[model samples]
Target: MPEKQRLTPTVYVSVDIEADGPIPGPYSMVSLGAVTAGWHDADGFRRADGKQGFYRELRPISEQWDPQALAVSGLDRTALLRDGTDPAAAMRAFTDWVERLRTGPDGRRYRPVMVGYPAPYDWLFLSWYLVRFTGGSPFGHSGCLDVKTLYAARAGVPLASVGKRSMARGLLPDLPHTHHALDDAREQAVLFANVWEWDGVSRSG
Candidate 1:
């Protein structure tokens, strides 16, 4: 690939998931949320406008559950069991939604990259579900961009030392971190934008 093409603009897809336990097969991803953060080009980051978001609650696949993990999301396991979207159908729809966001208004095909506060956990469930149900991932296997790691590198701090509270006020969004999947996904999109564009200046004023 040419240098220019390799550096082509990106469509950042922020993703969040709420699960019943630590792992996938033994547990379940109760809910999932995803949204476009925006286009990032030479100008800067601009949050996506009028782009639809994706959210789905899925029925549990196994009998194992952790009380603390279940409590955090507050999603009704019983309700999900009764009326949640099927995992295979939901994964297919999620991939389709992601594919739709790849084309820009000017006809440019942007690379769709998954953005997460801390990519591993979300990526774990998301990748597993995508590969398991849809047989592939729209963002590919290694396309996730971790906001936490991004901040740590840009801030010249140890990765473990970085936290949202430690970031510059301006680089952090005003949105609350409600544990709801969609709300947190939107909030995370804004956060990835801010951190990605920050100029290494700590802006508290």
Candidate 2:
């Protein structure tokens, strides 16, 4: 008889991005943050005891930026221009951090999965920068997990109707929605862990 194969755990990293415009390339991913929310395998879910993460602020790749977008994050573009890390350096550090997380202390490899609130927006900027500066994306093209979609599917609700406001109060994390990149990332990390452990039914139901 053939032996059963063991499955590798999936390490969920919650990601958030603060950009100067709606898209990448023409705009820029001004700041980004990622927190290791948890890991899951056959044994089920386990949340991280403490926030394990990475954050970087990058010098703008282009001068073009949407003022409205900057205002949303409350980050000063002028300050970033003067103090942000070089794009290449920031991407390199991010890559290294991701690699470390994927390779656990026991030397076994876990699949690194990027989780985000909406995902599309953050994934676009992070993927673009990773490819542009690091030659490839660590999360790859399909490794993203959108919390919004997860909630919609679990709650049996339409995607359009699954905003945070629509979620049950108990399902929501207590963290504040600070626009600061790292702060938001940590908040999203808590939300992701909660959603992951949910039994696909509302607590009140």
Candidate 3:
């Protein structure tokens, strides 16, 4: 029989999006950001646990822009219109970056899971964007991991109390602010690391 692959909890990409409503789709994704982190080997090759990756923003689709969402994210539509890169280009760039992380600077192949605090909320916009503009999902179906759920389970807390502020105060203790996707993603990563390292258990598993 083939060797069973151990669940090496590494290579995570955290995505966050500010959308117009509880759900994405016609509501529109106003802004998006992501951060990838893990461990790297001596050659700068991302080992399964390499703490190396990217954080970036993508311009919202002009025709599908949501005023209500913009109000919440505070991203300037006028500026985006004038200077934002195209959504398709942004998505392509993001995917290319992900590939670089998984492979090597020279190009190789590796697997990384996309992670988020509330996975579904962020994934909705990211998945929608990839499908709409990036041709296909580079992260794939097994790509997503929900740190919110994991933390709740590990700390014996309710999911209702697992938002950014809640997690920061309870688990992180030092994380400040919310709504900024990259910051939030980093906070969740730190929280996940704490739970996984100190507590010594796969919270999600």
Candidate 4:
């Protein structure tokens, strides 16, 4: 019998986006950030050392914006209008970054999977922007892994009940929730790895 080839390892890319409103088109994704959380194979999940990342502040395509949403990121729209990368250029760079991740820094070929906390909100914006600007997404039309849903299933809890506050402390690193896209993505990468490795059994008495 011939030997079988091993499946490509799964690489998790944690992503976070800061937007100017509720949705794309009428609004804008002011900033996009991402990092290679880790990879899983026959040896199991291993964290990325000196993780690779991508971040860009985008020029707004529409004038519409929500004050509360903009306030959360604390990013100035005026400054972005003046200096941010063009949306199309930014998306192209993002696509290139994702392609690079297919060959990890460790020299192993990997299958990159887009990961988001709850997923829907971030995914919606990312997908729309990628298609609108770059014409396609590196992760495909519907490819994504939701961290919140992953934990919910692992912990045997309701989807609506999962939140960082309810998660085990050790599962989350002592990183600040800066609301900055890159900072948040880095923190999320660690969280994704920790949760992925957790047994999900409650250790409480």
Instruction: Please give each candidate's TM-score.
Output: 0.93, 0.94, 0.73, 0.93
The Cα RMSD in angstroms, rounded to one decimal, for candidate 4 relative to the true structure is: 2.5
lDDT of 2 at 42: 62
Give per-residue CA lDDT, model 1, range 93-133, as digits (tens).
99999998889655778889999988899999999999999
Model 3, range 1-205, lDDT digits (tens) per residue? 3233533324566666776555555555656666664432333323223244354444545456557767776667776666666778877887887776676444534566787767887887788788788778778866887877777776677888867555433356366547776666666666655544445243333
Q: What's the residue-level lDDT of 58 in candidate 3?
A: 49
lDDT of 2 by residue, 27-130 (tens): 99889888888887665678885368798888899989999998888888898899999999999999899889987544667888899999999999999999
- Pick the lDDT winner: 4
Alpha-carbon runs more than 4 Å astray in model 4: 1-6, 202-205
Error of 1 at 154 (Å): 1.1
Better candidate by lDDT, 3 or 4: 4
State model 4's lDDT: 0.87
Q: Candidates' lDDT values, in order?
A: 0.86, 0.86, 0.62, 0.87
Worst 10 residues of 2 by lDDT: 1-10
Candidate no. 1 TM-score: 0.93
> Is candidate 3 or 4 superior in TM-score?
4
lDDT of 1: 0.86
What is the full ranking by lDDT, best candidate first? 4, 1, 2, 3
